[model samples]
Target: MSGVFIVSDNILSPIGLTTSKNFGQLKKSVSGIQKHHDTALSDQPFYAALFDQSGFIKDSDHKYTRFEQLLMASISDALQNSSVDAGDKKTVLIISSTKGNISLLETESYNPTIQKRISLPASAKLVAEYFGFINQPVVVSNACISGIMAILTGMRLIQSGQYENAVIAGADVISKFVLSGFQSFQAISPGPCKPFDVNRDGISLGEGAATIILSANPKNAQGIKVMGGAVSNDANHISAPSRTGAELCQAITKTLDNAHLLATDIDFISAHGTATIYNDEMEATAITLANLQTVPVNSLKGYYGHTLGAAGLIESIVSIHSLKENLVIPTLGFNETGTTNPLNICTDLLSGNFTNCLKTASGFGGCNAAVVFSKQ
Candidate 1:
């Protein structure tokens, strides 16, 4: 396979709704989550991560879903920071998300059926055309890991000569539908999420998007390269993470094997630590099984809240940026370590010269993924 380089990275999180603001907050340990007050049915008082940046496109005639708006803004920022063409190029756009227009599901009254909506793909198409991309792939992997899957697919397409370049985009927003869904699962944490913490309760929902540009070759000598990646399914549970963590470990193994690297070569790990007791415990075991203890690890969920389908790409964007800045931001709100397995909630961004890095994520539908990124 050919080398796939990460030409650019951009994250538009609630902590800093734009690229500059997001990076500013990253320098500090600021988080954007707080008790959501806009909805009446959300009685559990869920923490919501809402953006502070103004919607990039502003005009009475400009109309778009909140998801599209966030995605467009991030892609714009990513291109601005990259050597790749965002203005006029035959770029392939890959979009991933879970609850697309569930934000449109309105429970206006005390009665009526909750609507089943799917509008993310069409929205992505519109945003792609607006962003100057001539080609696009709409991926609504309703499965949680769909976000990272989008990034991986984009990297592969570029690496395999299928496309000269590709832009991977992921975005998701909270709504009554998503909130009620999490409430149904009782996965909404009233308190701050503590990934890998023993007393970890559950996830907090949020809205955000991250976009990365991948080229067949390095766009800038400074970009990170997508050396290898792997995906697998546990087939052991519907919503729960397996204690065996075999499938998760398999993905990591295949990824490192393909990259011709060892666990010891990875300087740090961006974990999917969702803060749920089962996920943290499961990931803790998987990391040890993969021999990742010597490498420091951290989770972004505590900082941005869980963006669902958007988590992987968003966090991956931050990872690439971390490689450029030479710092791995600490896991916000992570105070204690709880799992029986060996895991570390990195409390600070250790300064040093780093090169190879790993990112892993596990989600519903028994989906799991691991990716190897290298600074070129």
Candidate 2:
């Protein structure tokens, strides 16, 4: 916890595929949702913030899958943005994703499962080798919490004195499989997602990548400090998020414990308001359960849709940058409250003297994680 720190974080987002672009859209409150015409996949008609149509990559040669392409580009910029020496063979790479190039399963005419060739952990190797990282650890968290789990792993390495620096990347592309699967559960919404909204409907599928440079020593320049983090599981249902929010409460409490801070010390709560009826309610319940208040809580899903694994770093990057700018965009498309525990979702961008911001995300497999960051 002493030496472990942040070098820099970069996000390749659905808004612009770059931090500047992402920030540009944020200032304007632009929603990334777009209509889908993948008629072959479904006739129900769903809107998602898919990156495949972003037109940021070449379609020729090496035949890289969408997930791989996003991951590669994100890692490249993250290294440059953080000024990390990728040539350092001693550095380690930690990669995380729920579905790693899963689209390749159908393209290659193979069944999609854990035994497939496009293994999530294997993709980490592909990312590490790109920059000559010889020592690396791959975590294939199929659960929704994989992205945060991945970052916590890298933080653990720095805290345990196992690595001086760790480059962490998370990516997952929207595909027919992921889309149709969410559609099957009736979790696909037709418009912009409204996290914690009374009229909230379901989840929105988005794709992108987020990379962060983690250093064992505190940064002397610009960067947010990764004070501490914790992960948990509801154990209530496989897909039905628990209303008790026991796991979510524990995750934040433990993170605060590690940071030696109290609930009042936290300036903002980046709740995992996925806009779904269950996810929003659970997060609100968790915040109240933790006995936390006097903190502004909001979800960025409305701005960027749900970018899956990339959301952790993407949202964290925004949270860190906001510490200086003191701006958190209003939650777009929200018209009413839908849950018992009301969320103080900023409907208009607000500036405050905030120093510590917390980001929390919960995914499938009953998993959840929370991290606290401070101004450096």
Candidate 3:
């Protein structure tokens, strides 16, 4: 199969508007999370990484919501830097998001016209049309692994000769609906989240958008290559993950096998560490089962909070930069060992020549996805 290369990418978040700006903040151990007491989101004060909309100018013509603006901003940056033509007949657009334009329903202006935009597919079609994509847009909303799954889907399509290029973008804006849902489960952390730490509590909800351009043509694509990917479900629980971590481990193992790489070959792991007890434990067990217990691992949830659908893609782009820069960014907010199985959590930025990286994400409904990338 022909390798899918990440030719261009961008991250629009509270920390910065571009990939380099985001990475620059990460290298400094700076977090975008802050105490927020917005009654619209939650009655109680909570820490969250939110977009700084102070300078945002709403478009009166299109009436694009904040969520739509984020998606467009990130994809616009990526498309500007990429060689792929958005209007090409062979190019595709894939959108990954758990909830797209759902917040519009909460406004007093909600009506039949607004109701039509609540559907994920409808939002994707709007984005596709905005970008002038010739092919039908694809939407992936399978829990938190949606971003990684979308990237994997694009890779398969390009490798199968179905599309020559794919512009994948994901975004999720924090809303009262999402905030209250996690609050009901007591999954909201009062402060910054501490992933894989003994005193870790829960996740700090965040909102952001990310875009990655995957192309079969490697010309001008001096970036990381998408080697392989796999998705699996444990069918263990509705909201909880598999206790044994076997399901996630299977996905990781299969991804590595498909990439023709060994466990030891992976220099680092970008884990889906939400800082929640069950999630951290399950991920630790999975890494151990995959014989990657010793590999350096880190989670960006501490810095960016959990950005839901955009987490996987945003983190993957950062990992690609980490490989290119030969640096393993620290796992922010980690202090002590917390998991039953030992993990090499980088508490400080470590400089090294990284080659292969493994990015894994697990979400509700027992879904898990893993993707392997290599430095070109």
Note the Cα lDDT for every prediction shown. 0.78, 0.77, 0.92
**TM-score computed on alpha carbons, candidate 1:** 0.92
Best by TM-score: 3
Tell how far residue 125 is off in model 3, in angstroms.
Answer: 1.7
Off by over 4 Å in 1: 52-54, 86-90, 107-117, 140-142, 219-221
lDDT winner between candidates 2 and 3: 3
Clashing pairs in 3: none
Clashing pairs in 1: 198-338
Residue-wise C-alpha lDDT for candidate 3, range 127-159, written one tens digit per residue: 788889989999999989999999999999999
Which pairs of residues collide in model 2?
3-216, 144-363, 198-337, 198-338
Clashes of each: 1, 4, 0
Comparing 2 and 3 on TM-score, the stronger one: 3
Higher-lDDT candidate of 1 and 3: 3
Q: Could you say which candidate leads in lDDT?
A: 3
